[model samples]
Target: MRRDHPMPCPDRHDALAELALGTLAGQERSDVLAHVARCHACALELSELSRITDDLLQLAPAASPPVGFELRVVERVLACSTSAPTGRPRRRKRHRLASWRPAAVAALLAAVVGTGAGLLAASTTAGKAPPAASRPVTLSASLARHGRVFGHVRVSSGRTPWLFVTVDDLTGPGSRTVICEVTLVDGTTAKLGRFRLSQGYGSWGVPLAAPADSLRRALLVGTDGSVLASARI
Candidate 1:
């Protein structure tokens, strides 16, 4: 008979969602990753959610919000703020009240609205800004060497560009450190970061300092300083 695995922990739902959204960071992210590494259920959920997120990013033709939408949202928030209870505050509620900053409230409202529309809008100021409705431009190239493709690299454009890499069928030991480097338009090479490949397969992502368009190419380098594969961005 086959054995059943335990389901993901209830308390980890929020953390997993944040991780899937690429918002989890610092020690919290490390902690969640550690747990997911050991918990098969959580890892499976993360993978499913991540796939869904990738699908969502590929949605076509952006949508624009109606005029006065921001104004109306701001008015509604102010209306509630002015009408909120002014009576003697409860001792137990002080902490909650203190945590409710205007920016946080606005962010929450934006998130709620974005969730209903299926795409999270980037942060905007008072003026009317274009909605990030369509998917960001993503440039991709295959990582190849000796006429054989071994991996792929992609650059997604935004205020802060991101680089994604995936490697497979690498002829190497089970696990080893691999370096990711980018060649700038000016001919200077910068080391983006490093990641460990497990059993010749792994994927990693990192934010890039240079604009995606400014990168000429990407390289995957082995520990012995050999160029394993290169991709033209």
Candidate 2:
């Protein structure tokens, strides 16, 4: 067989037996060689036949066959020749066996690709920043300390806004406390209803009706009447 072309074995059994006996011609011999290379059972049978042939050749003249030996050999050869027509079943089985490999490979590839895509999506979503801590209080004193009228509102946006505040190191557990107040620039102040802070920051949201635009001038104050930060919306 050529490197690229598969060898044809129309009568696989006879080809295998001839290949074992080393009696096949050029193309037929190549075909049987290809088949045996890929088939362990055929290879073992070929090895056994070769050993038997070698042993027969080593027999002495006194051990030669009787007068009817040639006739018996011819009969056996005819019998094997008659059985050659049954090769179709073996060919069909081989074809069916070969068809499953590509299907299995395709299924494995699809699973790998699907798993990779899922992981990629998960990683992307996990990499994003979380929502800002609820309603944040902006203090006027902190904005004066920083020499800036504008500050950040660390609060999240929603139907009900929560208060979030950050305080400096004072006579408290940390720079954070649960007591704070939110005063808008419009002179309307909403007392800190309920709040909690960790590190230097805390949050709480009061159920008060205010215009969306007025939120920009909001200021957050600590419990000791000190401004923490201020924000415009």
Best by lDDT: 1
State the lDDT of candidate 1 residue by residue for 34-105, as single tens digits.
999999999988987899888988896787664224433443354355455565433211122222233433
lDDT string, candidate 2, 1-233, tens digits: 23233433445767766766778889878877887898766676677667887787778577654222332233233334444444432211111111222222222223222221232223232333332344433222232236643222333233322322223332245544433344444445554332334443332223223322233344555566676555544
Candidate 1 vs. true structure, TM-score = 0.43
Candidate 1, number of clashes: 0
Tell me the spans in candidate 2 whose CA falls farther than 4 Å from its real position.
1-151, 154-179
Q: On a 0 to 100 scale, what is the lDDT of residue 111 in model 2?
A: 28
Which parts of model 1 have CA positions greater than 4 angstroms off? 1-135
Single out the weakest 10-residue window by summed lDDT for candidate 2.
Answer: 90-99
